[model samples]
Target: MPDIEIRQLKKDDVAAFKAIRLEALEMEPAAYASSVEEWVSLSDDEWASRLHMPVFVAFKSGEPVGVMGLLRQKASKMKHRSTLIMVYLRDSARGQGLAESLIDAVARFAAESGVLQIELNVSSENGRAIRFYERNGFRAIGLIPAGMIQDGAEVDEVIMARRLT
Candidate 1:
C-alpha cells in the first residue's frame, strides 16, 4: 500500500468517517463498542460534533481509513479519566499496524492533554483486541457483564486502562 498520513478529524470528514464506522459495526459486529443502527440514524450535525471531538483519522491520500477518539468525562471526581472509544479501521487498512499506531497516538495525546488514565471497553469475545490493548500497555481492570448491549444481545466487556501519570 501507499503511505498513510494521520491527521485530526475534520468537519468535512463526516461522510468518510461514517462510512468506515458503519463498515466496522457491520462487518465486525462483535469487535466494536457501538451498533450499526446508532450510526445509521445520526444526523450530519452529530457527525460534525463527533469530528470536532478529540479524535484522529488515518488517511491515505486524503481518504479516511482509520479512526480513534478520547472522549473526556466531565465529572469532577473523574476529571482525570477519559473514555477511549471508536477505534476502527477499514478492512483494506487492517493488519498494517494502524491500530497500534492509533493507540500510541491516543496515548501520547492523552498524556499531553493532562489525563491521568485512559480507559476503553473491549468486547469479551474479542481476544485479539484485548491482547492488542494489553500489548499497548493497557491493563484489564475488571469485567462488566451486560456492560454493553448490542443488537438485542447482552455482551460482556473488559474495561482496560493505561496510566499516563
Candidate 2:
C-alpha cells in the first residue's frame, strides 16, 4: 500500500479534481453516465460548483488516484437517503484498498449528514465493481435491464444499497 490520503475535495482543488475525473470518464466510459465530452465542456465555474458537494478524493503521493461522491436526496420524502456517484479508481490504484477507502469516506460523510442509507447503480457487466460493492456491505436489491447504453450497446444496471443506521 502507498501513502494514501482520503479527503473531501474543495472548490480550490478544481484542477486536480478535473484531471482525475476526466481520466475516469475517459478510461471507463461504461462505468459512468457522464461522458468525457460533457465534463470537458464545462466552464471553470461549473466545475467549481460541483466541488461544493461532498466529493471524496484519494490522493497518493500528492496525486489523485480515486474518487467517490455523495448526493443526498433533496425531496422531503427522500431526505434520509443519499446516492453514491462518480466512483472510479485509476488502474494503478486498484486492488490496493483505495477504492474501499473512498467508499468509507463517503459513507462517513453521508452518515454524518443524517443520511440513513446510501444507494448506487453499477453496470451489471462490471463484475469487479459489483463484487467490491458487495464486499463493502451493499446488497443488490434490483436490476434495470438496458439501464445504460455505451456506444449503442445496451448494458444492465444493478441497484445496490447499504444501510447506515
Candidate 3:
C-alpha cells in the first residue's frame, strides 16, 4: 500500500472518472457491461449527470487509477439495497490492495446512506474478480445465464451480495 487516496468523485471530476472508466472498458472488455464506444459517444452533460451517483475513485500519487460506483435503488421498497457498478483497476494498480481500498470506501458510503446490503453482478468468466469479491465478504447468491452478450458470445453473470447491517 503506497498511500492510496480514495475519495468520492464530484461533478467536477467528470473527466477523471470518464478516463478511468473508459480505460476499464477498453482494458478488460468482458469485465464491464458498458463499452468504451458507449462512453465515448456521451455528451459533456451526459457525462456530468452520471457523477450524480456515488462514484469513488482511487488515486495513487495524484493520478486516478481505479474506480467503483454505487447505484442506490430508487424504489421506496428497495431503498435499503444498492447495486455496485463500474468497478475497475488499472493493470499497474492491481495486486496493490487498491481494489479493496475502493470497496471499503464504497461500503462506508453505502452504510451511511441507509443501505442494508450492497450487490453486484460479476461476469462468470472473471474468476479473479469473483474471488476478490468473495474475499471481501461478498457471497454468490444466484446466477443469470446469458446475462450479457458481446461479440456474439454470451457471458453468464454471477450475482453477489454483502450485508452491511
Candidate 4:
C-alpha cells in the first residue's frame, strides 16, 4: 500500500465519508452506531454536521479509507471531555499505521480544541480494538451494560479514556 495521509475533513468530502462509514457499518455491523444502508439515506446537512466534531480522514493514494472524529460534550460539567467517535478503517488501510495516524490527529485536535480528556465506547466483543486502545495509552474506565442495540440484539460497550495534558 502507498503512504496514507491523514487530514482534516472538508465539506466536499462527505461522499467519501459516507462511503467508508457505510462500509464500516456493513462490514462490522455490531461495532457501529449506524448501518451502511442508513447512512446512504442521510441528508446532505446531516453529513456536513460531521465536520463540527473535529473530523479527520485518511487517504491512501487519494482514496479515503479511514475516518475518525472528536465530538465535544454538550453539558457544562462534562465539556472538558470530548468523545472520540466514528473511527473506521478499511481492510486495505489496516496494518499500515493509518489508524494510528488518525488517532494521533485526534489527540492533536482535542488538545487544540481545549479538551482535557478523550473518551470512546468500544464493543466488548472487539478485543483487537481494546488492545489497540490500550497500546495507545487508553485505559478502560467503565462498562455500559446493554448500551448498544444492534440488529435487535443487545450489546455491551466498554468506556475507555485517554487524558491530554
Per-residue alpha-carbon lDDT of candidate 3 for residues 41-78, written as tens digits (9 for 90 to 100) = 89878988999999999999888899999999999999
Better of 1 and 4 by lDDT: 4
Q: Which stretches of candidate 2 lie over 4 Å from their true place?
A: none
User: Model 4, 155: alpha-carbon shift in Å?
Assistant: 1.6
Instruction: Report model 4's TM-score to 2 decimal places.
Output: 0.92
For residues 1-165, what per-residue lDDT tens digits would candidate 2 score against the true structure?
Answer: 557799998999999889989999989988999899999989889999998788889999999988988888999999999999999999999878889888988998898899999999999999999999999999999999999998999999999999998
Candidate 4 per-residue lDDT, tens place, 29-98, comes to 8888766777778897899886666788898888888888888998989889998888888886788777
lDDT of 1 by residue, 26-122 (tens): 8877776667877899999998887766787788777778878888888899878988888887778878888778777887888887899999999
The lDDT per prediction is 0.82, 0.92, 0.92, 0.85
Better of 3 and 4 by TM-score: 3
Backbone collisions counted per model: 0, 0, 0, 0
How many angstroms is residue 78 displaced in model 1 relative to the true structure, after the best TM-score fit? 1.5
Candidate 1, superposed: residue stretches over 4 Å from native: 150-153
Q: Rate residue 126 of model 4 by lDDT.
A: 90
Candidate 3 at 109: error in angstroms? 0.5
